[model samples]
Target: MSIRKLAVLLVLGGMAAIPALAHGPHSLESMAMPGATKTTSSSRATVSPAQLKPGKPQAMLIFVRDGRGRPVERFALQHEKLMHLIVVSDDLTFFDHLHPQYVGGGRFRVTANLPASGSYTAFADYLPQGGSPQVSALHLQAGSGSTASVPLTPDSPLSKRAGDLTVTLKLDSGSIAPGRQTPLTFFIKDGNGNPVTDLQPYLGAMGHLVVIRQSPVLTAADYLHAHPEDQGGHSMGAMAEMHHTHGERQQMAGMDQMAASQKAEPGSVSFKTVFPGPGTYRLWAQFQRNGKIITADYTIAV
Candidate 1:
């Protein structure tokens, strides 16, 4: 076959294979989180109706269980929330972070309103009482509408401007490699185009980064869900050390004792993340400055 025809076949094959593999990222336990004991994947999270109707509220049901066939009732609170549910469309466009209430008897209920009709994934991230953190997923289908393709900007924007402030992504290098940890950082500038010193706590943290894959290559764990701490796992420890300049080990040692509520300065919030495979991914960076929360989007290829 000709080169053009071959390329078309590859693209068509990928599109056809999506539905057969309709699931989100892998759980943290299977991903080998630090300080985490062996995580059992027997428990499951389910969604009622198997899909979300655009105008109605969707209910999500979660049941926590160990490797054995017994139901788990108690779950530890993390980040001041009982359970954090992340819903993302298969196209990687619409993203929502929700908190569900524990009703009782190892069951949790979450009523969420979806914006559109498309294929989506719901991930339940929580810490079971006296057990390792658990991340369970449920596949969801919404209405009959097709999902939109990933949006493309004219040029890959390094920085996004909002009013008087500019948020830019900083890194040791522009190119990211698979199976290696890359230090990702973000900084803000004032109206005068200078790094602002007025950066303060936002949502009780310096800044936050949410990583999602545009095209998932890993079926087990497809996204990096973290908030600058060990709530999910020790993923932030590597991210914290990436901020230090010269004394890498010394700064990392200090991070071991730091609390999640410590005040963080601008450009100081960095994460040492490892990309599992080569693909296009999007990173949403959120921060607070001058009593305002600014969200910026950046795309990277690995």
Candidate 2:
């Protein structure tokens, strides 16, 4: 399923308000870093996602290494942990933050039971020798009924390198008018100019894009309204109808709920959202591949 199709199903299913459930042995405290370094090592890591039986627990393996492609020590002191594994579904549901147990050496393993079959993204965040922190996004297909193996090769279209991913914002018109619904599409591609297909779920969705209005005039009242009665989980109406005009900031509402309703199915993932107020907005999309995590940022005027 395409990302857009997945988004439509999630909205129509009335399951947007559900919060993603976290399972496993690792805690956020163990993965926290006291400080981040500006430089990262040159080593290239690799990650692979194998499809497991539907309704059964699934697992993803991550292999870390040094600049020479040698596996690094599991308990390396350079970073807090050798590797951090994050799983997200296409629809932004089924988010899991797990610390894969290092099975000796540099191999890490995480156990996950995909609720259903679909395209999911697995991100590996780690520190390389003599380098700062690096992230990579990898695509995995579950329950597709096709036993064909999708290799994570350096030349694969779905596998984007550290410096190749980019996102561009385009509006239907030259400018967006207030109180009007506008269409926004994010054009994403790798450095080699390939469309990202196997977009795996990361943190419970095909991918996570955070958009924050830059104006101080944009407040919660102006962006999001309390949907105490919105049982259907459609919070866009409340946010778009906010009364405040300017000078307030609010995190996009309904993320936790949207993250919870994720179910695994086949295909790409997508969704639609409207900005409550008009201003310069910053959007961030995070994904992982090749045992590394990559975040792409874009600024747009709405």
Candidate 3:
């Protein structure tokens, strides 16, 4: 069967099995993009530290398979490329939108050089057979070191622009230790100083946050992380429960319809993130408004 058809079956199977599975770590939503109806599965797939090595350019391999665990080769309703892989670190430091060169037997491999020792998140975007595009997050740990505990002043101004949007970086506590959950907030408003409630879902979430360990040059070796934080200004912990909300369901449906119809938007969207370590890091937030795709980036020291 075609990859698209197989993808449809996989999605249906996942939905049917949802009740039998424990509550996942993340939620899924529709990110409305022109020519693509993107749905993201918040459940994070983890790659053990043993499977990853630090201080070297490592190759992360991914296989696109059906519910039956068979490889998927064609999609896009017309047997287009089977997958589009986007890799980002936890701190929003590295961003790579890669179309992996397909390796034989349904496996895709890309060279990723991790810069530091930390956790990273990988997003795989693909079309399941006869269904809308879907995104899944995978977590991989690299290197060896404790996360920094220095505290960031809450509501500290980081940067600003003329678009009436101001960006700030803050931490839940004055100090954070390794393996501990720290809350990071990104407050956004229009020129009117009101919360931008109409914040459309970008890349299957209210927003996409990519964090990378700072290096002289960007490399997969630099620690990379990617995640979809909660939409209501909460920390990432609540991400799992977000899927069942009415707003998320409506947004998912809207994204599928929008993609099926193929519409484009204008402008850019931006946000902020926090790193687990004391080193420098970079962030990229992607969003859509008025049919325009907006990408803003920033670099910060933790």
Clashing pairs in 1: 25-222, 26-220, 26-221, 26-222, 239-272
Runs in model 3 with CA error above 4 Å?
Answer: 1-156, 162-164, 215-277
Over 4 Å off, model 2: 1-49, 74-80, 145-302
TM agreement with the true structure for every prediction: 0.67, 0.34, 0.40
Evaluation by TM-score, superior candidate among 1 and 3: 1
Off by over 4 Å in 1: 1-46, 55-59, 148-155, 162-164, 198-204, 216-220, 229-235, 238-268, 289-293
lDDT of 1 by residue, 1-302 (tens): 11111100001101211111113564432332211112124332223345457757756555544444345667665544567777677676677777888877666767777678776666666666554455555555677765655653322557777667777777655557888877776667777877776555543345566676664222225667544543233455344334322223433333441443234443445555788777777677766667777767677776
Best by lDDT: 1
lDDT for model 3 comes to: 0.43
Predicted candidate 2 versus true structure: per-residue lDDT over 44-148, tens digit per residue: 221222344556775545554444434465343211245555554533334454566666545566676666776554445454333333444433446774222
The lDDT values for all models are 0.53, 0.39, 0.43
> How many pairs of residues in model 2 come into backbone collision?
50
The stretch of ten residues in a row with the least summed lDDT in candidate 1 is 4-13
Predicted structure 1: lDDT:
0.53
Backbone collisions counted per model: 5, 50, 32
